[model samples]
Target: MTTFSNYIPQSNPPLPPWETLPTMYDLPSDNPEEPGLPDDFHFLQPLLLYLTFQPINWNPELVYSAADLNLYYDIQHPLWYKRPDWFGVVGVGKLYKGQDLRLSYVTWQEPANPFVVIELLSPGTEDEDLGTRTESAADKPPRKWEVYERILRIPYYIVFSRYTNELLAFQLVGGHYEPMNLTHGCLLMPEINLSLGLWQGSFRDIERLWLRWFTLEGELIPAPTEEAAAATQRAIIAEQEAIEAKQEAIEAKQEAIEAKQEAIEAKRKTEQLAERLRQLGVNPDDLDEFL
Candidate 1:
């Protein structure tokens, strides 16, 4: 056997050139110019991310092409120009090359386009969201509905109003989007095996309209915060059940003691009666014989 110190160590190799190594830049915000997408936008991001892990081709923030410069569409836009609030593509890698960060997603550059698009209606963009034309035609883009239905040709489009707590979904047909009823406030996206709907509950100490993802069967997908609350609720229920069971056992024991006391009292009364009859010279045995 060779001794532990007998083996020789090899020299370490030199570091590779920085140019050969891949460089990744931070993701760009679509509404960087504006005061950012709004507080509700943050709330909507996670639900969009959760939808990607499903069986459908779900890319969270896929970059798609518009013109030339890689425009990373929030989810993935077909062109470099416009970006939907939340979008999904059915057949794209979650990440390119497991590390090839995308500068932008150009549909022409990518193999697929978004199957669905969601717009979070805010006070600033409410008009555009409702398909109303902008009065000034100088530098504004076309209405959102026209772009989503005609240009992008996204199969499904959803508009959620935080103020009204309402959701509207449209499906593409004959090169146009037709409004579809979301019965009981549930919109089912069959492509992704999920549904998009509004859940009226409190989150982060804020009680307001929350956009949430759901299963096809209308079960609200629990956020991390919601899951914790549910667990706590279950624990409380179990504790209550244990307390009730203990109380019931104590009540049963008390009832048994009371029953035994009653039996003793009744037997004592019968003995006293027999003794009184014996003192009165009327034998209790003679009375029993007559009866």
Candidate 2:
């Protein structure tokens, strides 16, 4: 049987689009000087990550997470740093020096390193994010991948692409990062007692697929806005129930008033009949025995 492949004139079959086009694997050169500026998606995605990052097992005061923060790692070269899209450091005070807010994260002065770092995929930064570059500039700081893996040894490194809605996660193992297999479209982090997954729901008045956190048991960690909406719905339901109860009480009261009126009318008719029997010279009291 002649197939579609046989219809081609060339001896070799044409390669698929995936082979010819540029992909995350073949991203551009890693030039730190030309770091891509963030767009609206970059701003929004990090905010979602920041809001839903509720580490249930950790104390609220100790769980600190932020987006677009410079993380200074090396003490020798204090100026050298990498600003991750979002990062979370557990077991550290939310305030710097336990007094005021921090401007940047300094590794040497901090109590602990970032437990996880997330990089939102931008076209210009994909190469460095995926560690495709073998080395960095001669006189400059190390690449982001090297800084996270070799220097800081962050426990988890995640890269998410909003354009493709793809999520990639790696865990530190034996001085190297090992890719983690997602279970049921979610990656579970037992340390945080939460799992990261794709949730197809509305956030910030926008409906789209979002990467949000869930409990290890698959319960959604609601944002503040969602909580407010749920509270409003509960209030509405409670008000309706109250109205129905009030109507029922009113109906019962009206029914009692009608029953009392009916009893008074019956008594008045009996008295009128007794008065008529006396006028006709018939004893009303002895009429029952005669009948």
Candidate 3:
């Protein structure tokens, strides 16, 4: 009698799951299950994060950040995902595999997970964003906090409320997230050489207290627009300085010419006086000795 058994096939040299598993294109990037459009703050805050998410220790080409992008964490459940307001990853290509733009951030296919994630608080998602909400069913998806802390194990998690202008931060330690104390109004992450804090400034022409990235020393990271503006201002100042330097040089030259003219005029007057003295039988060279 022949026994029937299941046979598993394997690849020689063992191809990684990324090559065999569903890629970003196979995953659904849209949030059709959820309803409602993001408010203006949602759009603006994330934009600011995306613009200034330059990790000082990481290469610019290797740093990638997204806002409102689906982050697929579970390989078993490829469909499950969380859309972070803003998330940043280091040691990963800015583009997908250095070739194409990513439709979604698939953790299994990517080299590294998000190092930091920011959630902008709203009335609807405040509980979930702050880890106050718990999943009612086992089959249901985990909360945002669970995914960030337990599953993906993101190093830094930040939440900000525009309404209250409050900033909260958490650091993953010993497989769990602990509340991080703000050091001088900012959460310092020395690994990435950056800080997360609230800035009372204008972004996108809207003036308010906004969540922003900062240097480890608590200096604000300039956005692209701000950097451009700073460059222009520097150029203008340089031009003004050059103009002032040229004017000073011209004034010095004029003074030198005037001094030379005065010396020549005095020499001519002395020569005339000497000639007149000679004509009167007096020596002009002896005048200084007499004086």
Candidate 4:
């Protein structure tokens, strides 16, 4: 008999040639390169990224993957690359297949584009983030504002300034970003089913309002560790209550047994007194007349 493997036809798409792919650390020329930001800026970037990864209800379906703060997006254009301080892409698989890992996010290869982009403003890129001036308007691939708001068409754009403790949120409307007003330092993103706000709490020993996500009712979203801790506390309380109830039942049973034994002893003593009167031979019938 002919082997089944030989009968089946093999079909596979040809992989791209190695020469077309750029080498590691290959950054585009037009990319706004901020080699070094302030220490506080660096510290806040990872914290915000971690907070985004923590909350359970934020992305129940796990559509987005919270990528590293420094990973670059390799746009097909030779001289165009955009890297956000922190970014999240919806409708992308959490892991690339089983073996292939992403060194950098290439838009053509990835499943979906970034839905929201966050820029932690520094001294160098503050003006560009706010859409103030464009040095290479005609020559270069537009300004950062035009690229983020117009080209990429990202739904939500957030800029946070550590120097001034300022937070600004913009929502895409009519193919452009419009500044969104905040009520009590909170802006709701209905598309993502969450709110972006400044949370005042101690993270890594710093007490400040760090850029974080929250629920619709203005509750701070819980990290993975915090959720687990809450579940453990509830389990401990339930176990203690069960033990206390069991102990009470045991004590009640013991009290009931003791009461039954005392009644038996009292009945036995009364019977003995009656027998003693009979044994005294004083005529049980005559004892009633003497009384």
Candidate 5:
């Protein structure tokens, strides 16, 4: 029989890297047991949300934000958890138990559920993040959508796609999550007196479109570092203005002294002229009008 290899010919051209190589997400670690590695976008997008979230009506001490932290929801299961990309809580202390940093968020223990939850979409977890992924098994833990929508009943939900630069928002209305349209490139949440939106700017020296919080009127709520920088600038301007005022005062004083000297000299010359006129046998009193 003819060999199978003899009938197969070499390919005409080499396959491109896209076709030949595995993507980063697909390339598993040598340790299959190890957790998946997080890419740079995953690191940055959540940090932006953490930094810019400032609730206008809430107490700063009671406002807490978490990223990639396990949130235990069900008291019955006690082990069932959903780790959001980023979540913000109002009326919860930044510290766990009001004294220590949180290792993980326990929803039953906290006073309230998160006011807002944001997820940055990646190819690996896109379907589940958007709540479209089906149950892997009937008895497996509930999907993220069910946990947030039904169990926790989180007030606001947000998902952002880095590849397409798309942002979507949902609000809890009538016991269900409802899609909310962007008003002037922003989604306003009246409860917090703050808005969420995308802004094109540099953060951490990397320039890109970043999601940030804004005032309901669409004013950016500045980060703490930005607030400090602006305060420093104001101080510098105030110092410069004070220096200019001082210089102007000094110049005005100098001009007034010079004017006084000129008036004194003029009076002195008039008296001397009167003495000379008297010496020339002219009556100074009679020459007063001409002088």
Candidate 6:
């Protein structure tokens, strides 16, 4: 029974809250609105990727990787981004512009897109990470698959589930992603002279199946701690070998001294025997003729 004209009129159509709300910059990086915050596995798995993402064919200074960092892809929508679990770039500097740490990875500003992106599948993000999620509406931003595959065109996309210890990998080919085959239990990337595979062992003192890097020949790439431990072991072995060598030298010197002492004693006995033969009035030089 109230007159409709009395109420304040709204716009022709109200925009969605996302369209009018604060941009990514206005909100804190860890804002509640952000999805996929790192759980225990998410944190550790990405760390493993970051530690062992060495590309033997590339310069160490030019190889860079990051975890859970905002990767701004679209220049049109500068605020739109995806925070990958872990990503690596081959031609980028370790620091932003070789001067400072990067707050986020902006593709438009950077020289290269990610060569590889790894997503740890979780209950919350399994569908999206595997590219099976429902497509987004036309007005909404594209899904992670679309962003990585179609927009950014990342070379490699990897998904791993810790619960089942399963690994899935895709390589971009002819502008679309194709499932990659595992060679020798690893996905080989010859350009980097490296491989990606799951390793069953202890990491960070926790033993489990973990996704890690390897050589194309299926050799495990040692983490920094593992490398340090190996170096220590080599040093210990070298020290032991040196100690053994020193003991051998000492034994040889002692044997030579004993031989010299024995020779001296024999000479002294011979001299005394000669003196006795002379005192007995028997010429010692005549003994050879009697023989």
Q: Identify the candidate with maximal TM-score.
A: 3
Q: lDDT for each of the candidates?
A: 0.65, 0.88, 0.88, 0.69, 0.85, 0.91
Tens digit of lDDT per residue, candidate 6, span 128-202? Answer: 888897499987778899999999999999998888888999999999889999998999999899999989999
After superposition, candidate 5 runs with Cα above 4 Å error: 1-37, 134-137, 272-291
lDDT of 5 by residue, 119-235 (tens): 887555677777777464666778777788888999999999878999988888888888999998899988889999999988778999989999999999887777888899999
Error of 3 at 114 (Å): 1.0
Off by over 4 Å in 3: 1-36
Error of 3 at 9 (Å): 90
- For model 1, residues 1-291, the per-residue Cα lDDT tens digits are 767789778798767876466543232345644422546444544353343224323453443212112323333333335545666666666565447756555566566777776777765676766676634354545556776777667898777776686778889989977888785677777777777777766666667667667878887767666678899999999999999999999999999999999999999999999999999998898887778
Worst 10 residues of 1 by lDDT: 64-73
Q: For residues 167-227, could you state the per-residue lDDT of candidate 2 as single tens digits?
A: 8999999998899999878898998898888888877777888888889988888888888
- Deviation from native of the Cα of residue 50 in model 3, angstroms: 0.7
What TM-score do all the candidates reach, one by one? 0.59, 0.75, 0.84, 0.66, 0.80, 0.81
Q: Candidate 6: give the clashing pairs.
A: none
Best by lDDT: 6
Candidate 2: TM-score? 0.75
- Arranged by lDDT with the best first, the candidates are 6, 2, 3, 5, 4, 1
What does candidate 3's lDDT look like per residue over 174-200, in tens digits?
999999998998899999999888898
The true-versus-predicted C-alpha distance at residue 89 of model 1, in Å, is 5.0
lDDT of 1: 0.65
Clash pairs of candidate 5? none
Flag regions of model 1 displaced more than 4 Å: 1-82, 89-113, 122-153, 161-166, 191-193, 215-219, 275-282, 289-291
RMSD from true fold, candidate 2: 9.9
**Candidate ranking (TM-score, best to worst):** 3, 6, 5, 2, 4, 1
